[model samples]
Target: MREFDVQLLTDAVRRMAAQSNQILSPDVYAGLVRARESEDGLTAQSILDDILRNADLAAGKAMPICQDTGMALVFLQVGRDIHFQGDPYEAIQEGVRQAYEENYLRKSIVKDPLRRINTGDNTPAMIYTELIAGNQVKVSFAAKGFGSENMSQLAMLKPADGVEGVKRFILKAAREAGPNACPPIVIGVGIGGNFDKSALLAKQALMRPLDVRNCDPFYAALEDELLEQVNNSGIGPMGLGGRTSALAVSIEVLPTHIAGLPVAVNINCHATRHAEEVL
Candidate 1:
């Protein structure tokens, strides 16, 4: 067995949280650049340009790309042979706390859903862990802002509804989100699984690089189709109206009961910020 110190995890998470907020990941940055180049509408092009500039400025100055620093989300792939020195969850939370406090990232997490009191240090990161065969621990961190997150949708459709139903629902969600979720968004789609699992899959999908496609041929084709349909909505950048409404659509799928077809859409803004580290 390989032994690992909790402090190592803590420090890694802290650095990820801080760095992710300040830098737009390369895939996302590249997507934005492509959007800016392809956008036909002058206004939409201008908006895309501004977004690129904002990303550049944030990276150069070590500042958050958006004011809404977002809730801390940590995805961990733990090796079966690895042993942690302390409670991994607590270590992750500590990293979030330190990052938020030291980096001056906005404190957006609240203690309770209805009570509405700030958590102060962005503690208790939403952590998800999966055990794998290797000896290294892989961490994927995303600072998920609510403007886009609030617009996400989940639906349980009849298996009879099939692909058509899924397509319609996704388009409807994008149309409804229009200006609200921020245009030129990255769409993370989850198909199959139960209701909650579908949602989790959708959220996880967003962490994937924009350039990558689902391994399944069917899902990969669906992603391409959905991207075309969403951009055709002409919602544009910041919802001003153009052909670049969405930068990319990523879909993830899992087996589900025959009676149900659960689908979730997790919308992420142009500043889809995330970082990863393997140790």
Candidate 2:
């Protein structure tokens, strides 16, 4: 078995957290640029320009892209062949703590939902771990802000509801989210699975590169269709009015019970901050 130091994992997360906050993912940045160029409405185009400039300035000066650096969400895919020298999970938390502390990223996490006590260091990252075949462990990290998160939704449809039903719910969700979700949003959808798994899949889908489509032709086609409908939403850049309501729509799916069709939509604004590392 290959032995690994949990500290190494911690360091990686810390670096990723600090860096991701400043540098928008390349794919997402490109999508924003394209949106700016295609927009004809002067107001919409101007908004896109400001967004681009903010992104560029953030990266140049090493500043958080948005004041809300957000709660850290970490996903780990580990190989069974590897053995950790320490608790990898705690190490991940430490990474988040150090990142927030050192980089001055806002500590947005709370100790309790009701009590609303601040965590101070942003410890106890939301972590998910899975086992795979190789020795390497892959980490996926996202800094999820609440503006779009608050607007996300899930609908457990009847199996008979079918594709048309799915489309209706999705469109409705986007329309309702409207300006609240921060327009020119990126939507991550998870179809099938149980309710909880569906939500997790949607969150995972957000990490996918905007330029890549779902590999399955079926889902890819659905993605394109949903994207068009959302863009046609007239929500525009910051929800003023334009053809750039959403930057992209990505879908991920898994088989589910014959009676159930659970779908979750995880929406993110133009700045869908995320990063990944394999170690």
Candidate 3:
């Protein structure tokens, strides 16, 4: 069995938090470039151009992509063959605090949900842990800003609603979110799991690269078909109206109880920021 230092996990999380805020993934960048070329509306095209330029500036200058630096959310997969040297949770939180302060990331997290007092250092990152079968620990950081996160939704659909119902539900969610989630978006749809699980699944789906699809052939086809339908809405870049409002539609599915079909839709703005590291 391999023993890993908790400090390494903490440091990696911090680095990921800092990196995600400044860099748009290469796949996302390439997709946006393609959209800029094919988009017909001059105004819409201009908006896309500005977005690309801003992303470039963010990376080059080491500045946060958006003013909202976002709350840090870490997901970990710890292998059964691995042993941790220190307190894992504290390590993760310390990493989050140090990263935000040192990287100059804005501290948007509040201490009390009801009181709304700013924590000042973006500490207390939301972390999820899962045990797996390897000898290494894999950490992924997704800095989710409140603007787009607020626009997400979960629906407990009737069993009779079926796949068509799910399609309509997601479209309606997108329509309601109009321009708020920052157009030229990447949509994550989670279906079949319980409400909370479905919601988390949708957000996690955002971490997958823009061009990748579900390994399941059926879900892959659904992802492609959904992307086509969402783009047809003509929400365009930044809601200016064009053929490329949404860059991709990704879905994650899980088995559910026989009584209900729960669907969750998580919308990520053009500035979707995520990074991962394994140790």
- lDDT of model number 2: 0.92
Task: For model 1, name the residue pairs that clash.
Answer: none
Error of 1 at 35 (Å): 0.5
**Candidate 2 wrongly placed segments (more than 4 Å):** none
Off by over 4 Å in 1: none
**True-vs-predicted CA distance for residue 18, candidate 2, Å:** 0.5
Off by over 4 Å in 3: none
Worst 10 residues of 3 by lDDT: 172-181
lDDT of 3 at 123: 83
lDDT of each: 0.92, 0.92, 0.89
In terms of TM-score, how similar is model 1 to the real structure? 0.98
lDDT of 3 by residue, 17-128 (tens): 8888999878889989989998989989899999999999999999998989888889999999998899888999998999889988999999999999998889889999
- Per-model TM values vs. the true structure: 0.98, 0.99, 0.97
Q: Rank the candidates by lDDT, best first.
A: 1, 2, 3
Write model 2 residue lDDT over 81-199, tens digit each, in one string. 99999999999999999989898899998899999999899877999988999999999899988999999999999989999999988888888889887889999999999999999
